[model samples]
Target: ASRCAKVRSSDVAVLELERPGSNARHRISEEIARAISEDKAEAIVLGCAGMADLAHSLSEEHGVPVLDGVVCAVTLAESLFKVGLKTSKIGGYAAPRGKRFAGMFAPLSPAG
Candidate 1:
C-alpha cells in the first residue's frame, strides 16, 4: 500500500497477487514480467517485505528496477529517530508483543 502511495499517479501501475504466502518469487516475477511485456513498466517495486528479500532475484529475472519498501522504510525511520523523533503514545498503536487476539487467525506470529 505504501508503494502505491509513494508512486506518482501518472507514472506507474500497481498490481497485487492474491496469496503472497504461497509463491513469493514466481508470483511477483510473473506479474512484473507481464507488466514489462504489456504495460511497458520500467521498474517493479516489490509490494511485500518477503518480496523485498527476493528483490534482487526478481530484478535480475525481469531485467527491471526492483525496490524493497523495508529498505526504504528503515532508512527513513532511522533518519527520523536520529533526528529526535518519537511515536504517538495515545493511539491504539502499540507493540505487538503485549497484544491479545480474538480472530479467525488468533495469536498470529512470524515463521522463521
Candidate 2:
C-alpha cells in the first residue's frame, strides 16, 4: 500500500515474500522478525486489527511485547475508568460558558 502511494524511504520495510491475502500467524511473525531486525526495534506492534488475536503468541515467540492498538485502547480505557480518572459533568464535561453564534449554526450557541 505504501509503495502504491509512492512512499520511498529507508524508514519503511516491506515483506514481499509473504503470500498475498494471507495474514496467518507464521507470516505475520516472519514479518515482525524482519522489521525488528532491520529497524533495530525494541518491540513489535501489530499493524492490522485482524492481528489482535495473535498479539500474545507473537510476543512470546519474539521475546518482546507485541502490541495491538485496539487492545491497548480498551485496556487504557478500562484502567482509567477503574481509577476514576474520567470526565465528570461537574468539571471538564460541564456545558460551555455563555457564547454567541451567528448564521446557520446560530442555534448551537451555548446560551441556547
Candidate 3:
C-alpha cells in the first residue's frame, strides 16, 4: 500500500484507501473519489488495477490522470532489463533546449 511505503523511512508521502469491490464500477468510483478529495494527493493513483477502464471519468472529477499497476509493472520490467530504455534513450526523456525568445511567457517564471 502507498501509505505503508510512505511510512517506511523512504521519504515517500502516500495515502491509501481501499474499496469494497473492484467488479462493482460505481463502488470503485465512489471510493476513488472519496480518497482523492480526502487524501489531497499531488497525483492520484488508482488503487485497483482493474480500474484502468475508467481512467477518463476519474481524471475528469479529480483533474489528474490515474495510473494503473499493470502499466507500471511493464514499465519497470523494461527499465530493469534495459531492453527498450537504453536502446531508445530519447523515448523516455528529453531536455528543453536553450534558445532566446521574446514573449509574454517571460513573466511566467518566478524570478521574472
The prediction achieving the highest lDDT against the true structure is 2
TM-score-based ranking:
2, 1, 3
Off by over 4 Å in 2: 1-23, 88-95, 100-112
Could you estimate the TM-score for every candidate? 0.48, 0.57, 0.44
* Preferred candidate (TM-score higher): 1 or 3: 1
97, model 2: CA deviation in Å? 4.0
What digit string (tens of lDDT, one per residue) describes model 3 on residues 1-112?
7652121111111222234433355555565566556665545565555556666777776676666767778888878788544444364566445555458766555442
For candidate 2, write residues 36-102 as lDDT tens digits.
6776656776665666777898898888888898889899999998998967777768977887888
lDDT by residue (tens digit), candidate 1, 9-81: 2221233333445553565566677777766778766656645667887787778878898898999999999
Q: Model 2 shows how many backbone clashes?
A: 0
TM value for model 3: 0.44
Candidate 3's displacement at residue 106, Å, is 77
The global Cα lDDT (0 to 1) of model 3 is: 0.54
C-alpha RMSD by candidate, in order: 13.2, 8.1, 16.6
